[model samples]
Target: MADEMFRAPVNRSMRTLDRNSFRKVIPLHAARVPENKNISKVRSELERSKDALHQDRLGSVFPDPDRDRAKSGTKCVLLRPGRRKEATETGDNPHDGAEVTSPPLYSSVLDALLEQNIIDLVPYSLYLDYSYWTYHDIISAILPEDELGEVPSGFSQVGHVAHLNLRDEYLKYKHLVGEVLIDKNPGVRTVINKIDDVGEENAFRTFRYEVLAGPDDLNVEISEEGCTFKFDYSKVYWNSRLNTEHRRLVSTFKEGEAICDVMAGIGPFAIPAGRKNIFVWANDLNPDSYTSLQDAIKRNKVTSYVQPFNEDGRSFIQDSAASLLTTTQT
Candidate 1:
């Protein structure tokens, strides 16, 4: 059985994210203490204890100003979920209807603090909403139990667009997964899933894709190596993951050297090299890529050093070499 506290209500029918359906109330043990100079020491001890709650967004210590002890300036230091045996013995079971229990803690530090009257263990209800869980957490819980471990959490971001290449098994839940991705990732306004493998549809490396969530806008702008590039994501190929390779290749070109990019895609190599005062003859067979390359050269203020060409890679290689040789001889 899934851990009830962290589990999202599974609804395979869910197309959009239903935030209200993810609300959960978890009962836990908290160390209540008076607000004084020694409070920091008490917190430090609790944090070091094996029983302390450790979650990403949820803090271990919280100030409940509206509680009865708030008038005397007291705070609650939360502990991890108690074992079924501990909860049942005290008749304060947090997992009321759940079968599985978290590992029981035998914290010596907590025992010593309790014996000294430094802290008291009290029941606290932790209310968790949609924002508490991360993209992985939410996706893992919503997907089928068998597919839980292989949740589609990875995606490439191009400006406001998130590109995903989902497996065939997860295609049915593509829209649902895309919706959750947008909810968790800020500034991501569009999500797309590649319907075909790269180069399978065309030699240009552009693939057919479906808009899983948000608008169908594919025009995006991204900055790399101090240069900005703008392109239509669906028409031309661009991979943010290749930024390192682009930089490594561009760094090798000398200022006065002539570089020929036979298959330049949106001027990743040519534009950055041109920025360094290298003369580049950039060519692409894809008309869209050629157009974007020209735009990028102008956008990055490298028009004088970077020249764009629309031709086959083989033809551009021979022609550009001959042109460069003629220019050098003159």
Candidate 2:
């Protein structure tokens, strides 16, 4: 059977979306009810019926656009997918030949409506536009038919930036995917694809990336565990996925306890723990991470409890332990 659902227009050559191209007209079944007090009752019954339309971001009930709301008291409650009836001679009303009998799936609903004497099933032409299609739907439609099931729909968000790790096959359509992501996600203004693996070239866990869409501003501020951290996303390492781990680790530290974070990057661990009055000696080897760590400490107003250091993890551990021991002795 042919697919009746709306799909994105297939146009690999097009960089921007052609709104007109995505327009689709599909036939649906709708029940017209009087504008009386029982209108809500009729609608509720239809909505609970199995044959009611249930599409994401689309409402099942719609006003009769041809009639003025103040003048007319009738509304249309759309049913699930159905066949279209032939239009009348004037081609104005498509409600011709709408009988009381319905498909088996909706027979119970039809009987209830008939008993209430407040329903008239009619044919409706649903016009779906560009905004109707979701990111997965559009990406699946645009990619090659063979690669339809393998659409790259997953991405990591860092503030307003969306980071995608496109496979080798998807690199050619990286820009198109990025554009769709930005259009679908209102909060994301920029999209980038990781060109290299994390920590592949450096111990800082930073990787090279290319901008797929939007501006190249990587400076971002994000809040976690009641603390706000600001840093350059491109220069420092930040993974929102580790938020749970950070929270779990910070919860273990008590007030007035000393924490020596040898590999702290941008103060994800240090700043939150410091908020509880814990003394944290956060250290990192990368100068960029160290700079951002210090900035985060100052921004969060935890400078008195959180101290920033620039040193390798191996040496920082020994130095921090010695300093702690000396402080206790003194």
Candidates in order have lDDT scores of 0.83, 0.80
Task: Please provide, for model 2 over 78-191, each residue's C-alpha lDDT reduced to its tens digit, 9 standing for 90 to 100.
Answer: 777754343323424456644343235465876678677777777777888778889887777677777766789889999899999999988888888998899899999999
Give lDDT: candidate 2, residue 245: 98
Instruction: Give the per-residue lDDT of model 1 (tens digit) for 1-330.
Output: 226665655665565667787888787878877656657777788777757787767788776434777666778788877655444332256567544444455377888888988887788888888888888877776777887767898899998999999998898888888898999999799999988889998899989999999999999999999989888999999889999999998888888898788999899999889989998888999999999999999899998888899999988988898897666457
Q: Best-fitting candidate, measured by TM-score? A: 2
List TM-score per model, in order. Answer: 0.83, 0.85
True lDDT of residue 144, candidate 2: 79
Clashes (N, CA, C under 3 Å) per candidate? 0, 1
